[model samples]
Target: MREHRGFEALGQAVALAEPPLIESSARTDVGVHRRVNEDAVFADGGVYVVADGMGGHEAGDLASAAAIEPFRALAAAHGARDYRMVEATIELARRAVDTVSLRTERGAGCTLTGVVLIEHGGIPHWYVMNVGDSRVYLHSGAELTQLTVDHSLHAELLAEGRAEAADTPRNVITRALGSGDSRHDAWLLPVHAGGASWCALTG
Candidate 1:
C-alpha cells in the first residue's frame, strides 16, 4: 500500500541498499494476460518482499497487501536482529491477513516471500521468509540459487517421496496468508561481501 500499484503490462524497478555495503535491484512485471495485476512488491533498505495474491477474486489484492503490512513496519524499523522478533511479526501479519479474509464473503489469500537484513553475533545476515509458492533466490555473479522451499501441494508431494504425485501442478499451494494457515518457513544467512541479489516473484 505504500508503493506503486501493479499495472497490466507494466514493469517496476527498485534499487535497495544496505548503505556502504549492499546494492540490490528488483523488478515486477504484470505481463499481458491478467486484467488486474494483483501482485505487490516492497523494496527498501534491508527489506525486500513480494506477495502474489490469489487471482480471480478482487479481495486477493487486499490479502496480499495485508500479508506484507507487518513486514513493512518491520522493515521501517530496520527489520529484526533477533529471530524472535521475526516470529512475533509473522503472527501479527497472519492476524492482519485473516482480518482481510473475514471481511470478504469469498475469502482471500496470497503467497509471500522476502528477505530481511539482520545482525547476528555482530555480523550482518539475511533473514529469508516464504509462504505459499512465491520464491526467493540468491544471485551471485552469474549463478542463482533458490533459498526458500515453497509451501505448495507439489512441493508437499515431493517431500513425501511420492514420485507419482510429483506431476502435481504448482498453483495448488499448501500454505498461504489468509488461507487459515499461520505457518511459514525462514532462513538466516550471512550477508555476502560481494553483494548478492534476492528476488521474490508474484506477478
Candidate 2:
C-alpha cells in the first residue's frame, strides 16, 4: 500500500507540470545472453518494450523473439495509454512464454521486461515489469536507483551479503523461458513524475 501511494503521488506530481519522460535500450545474444528494456510517458500512458535475443544458441533467438512478440501485439492491440491494457498485455506474454518449447543449447532462454507511461488529468505515471536477471534502473535527478530485483540465485546471495561485489557467481539463473518452467510472473513497479526518470531492463 505504501509503495502504491508513493508511486501515485509521484505520478500525480509529474503529470501536473514535470512532463517526465522514460527511455530504455537493450541487447541480446540468445542462449548466451538476453536483455529487456522499456520506457514510458506516464505510469499508465505511453509504453515501450525491447527484448534482446541471446546469441550462441539457435533457441535463444527463438525464445527472445517469441517472448517479445506478445508484448508488441498487446501494445499494438490495446495501445500503451491504458493501464489495464498494459497489465493484461503482460499476462498475455506470460502465457505465451509458457506455451513455448525450450531448446537443447545450454543456458538457452529469454528475458522479458517492460514499462508503461500513463497520464491522468495531465499527470504522468509509469508502470514497469520484469522477469529473469534482466534489470530495470531509475535515473532520477543525479541518483540512479535499481527498480527491479533479479530472479537469480546470485542476486539472492548478494542480497544476503553472501556474495561480494557485482562479479559473477555460482547458482546463476537456473530457469527461464522454454526451460520447462511455465508461469514467469513479472515484477511490477510504478513510476511517478518529479525528477527525470528512465528504465534499463538489461539481461
Candidate 3:
C-alpha cells in the first residue's frame, strides 16, 4: 500500500497573554487492494484539509488532487478567515474536480473536509467545512466528539430508520465535489487551548 504522511504546527502563537500552541499530524494509506492512494491533504498555516477521492472511479487520485489544490494555494497565502473566502475556495475546488470528471468521463469526484483557525472578538475559533462522508472530530480531555455529519446514503438511511448502520454500505456518499452540488456544511466554534481536533477521510 502507498502511504503518505504530513505534519504542521502553527508557530505564530495566538496573541493571547498566554498563547496556545497548535500542532497537527496526518497520514493516509492506500488499502492493500488498491493500486494507488486517492486521498490528498493540506495541513499548514492554521488550515487543514482532507479530500478523499471516490473509489471505483477513474482518475480518483487526480480528482482528489484537484480538490485540494486550491486550499493548498490559499494556505500559502496565510489561509482564509472570512466565510466567503472559504466558500469561494470550495467552489474553485469543485470546478477543478469537475474539469477532471469531464476530461476522464468516468464521474470523477471527491469528498472534502477541512478546518481553519479564525479569530472572533480577539478569541480563536475553528471554522469547519464538510462535504460527503469525510469527518472532523474534537478531542477534549478523554472524550471524543464528532463535529461534522456524514453526507452519505448510509447515514441518511440510519437516520430515517430504514437501515441499520452495520448493514449499510459506508462507501455510498450522497454528496461530493464534481457532482454539480457545491453546497457544504459549516460550523464555527471556540477553540480551547487544551482541546485538540483532527480530520479523517474514511472509505
lDDT of 3 by residue, 43-143 (tens): 88777899988886788899999998998767776533665566678888888999999998568988889897666546676768788889988766677
lDDT of 2 at 12: 27
Best by TM-score: 3
Note the Cα lDDT for every prediction shown.
0.71, 0.51, 0.76
- Tell me the deviation in Å of residue 191 in model 1: 1.2
Per-prediction count of colliding residue pairs? Answer: 0, 21, 0
Superposed by TM-score, candidate 1 places the C-alpha of residue 185 at a distance from the truth, in angstroms, of 0.6
Candidate 1 segments whose C-alpha is farther than 4 A from its true place:
1-20, 56-58, 78-80
Lowest summed lDDT over 10 consecutive residues: which window, candidate 1? 1-10
Q: Which regions in candidate 2 have their CA more than 4 angstroms from the true location?
A: 1-45, 52-58, 77-80, 102-108, 119-123, 163-171, 180-197
Residue-level lDDT of model 1, residues 1-203, one tens digit each, is 11111212112222335532656676666669776667878887677788888874448878877877887777777434565566676777778878888998888888888887766555566768777888988777889888788787788888889985667887888778887564777776766555666667662
How far is each candidate from the true structure, as Cα RMSD in Å? 8.8, 6.6, 7.4
Off by over 4 Å in 3: 1-19, 78-80, 163-166
Ranking by lDDT: 3, 1, 2
lDDT per residue, candidate 2, 1-203, as tens digits? 00111222332233245455544444433233235322111122245564433443345555665666656555455432655565666556545544543335354456665566654444445566656666657776788887666667778767788746267553366335544442333333444444455665555
Residue pairs of candidate 3 with colliding backbone atoms: none
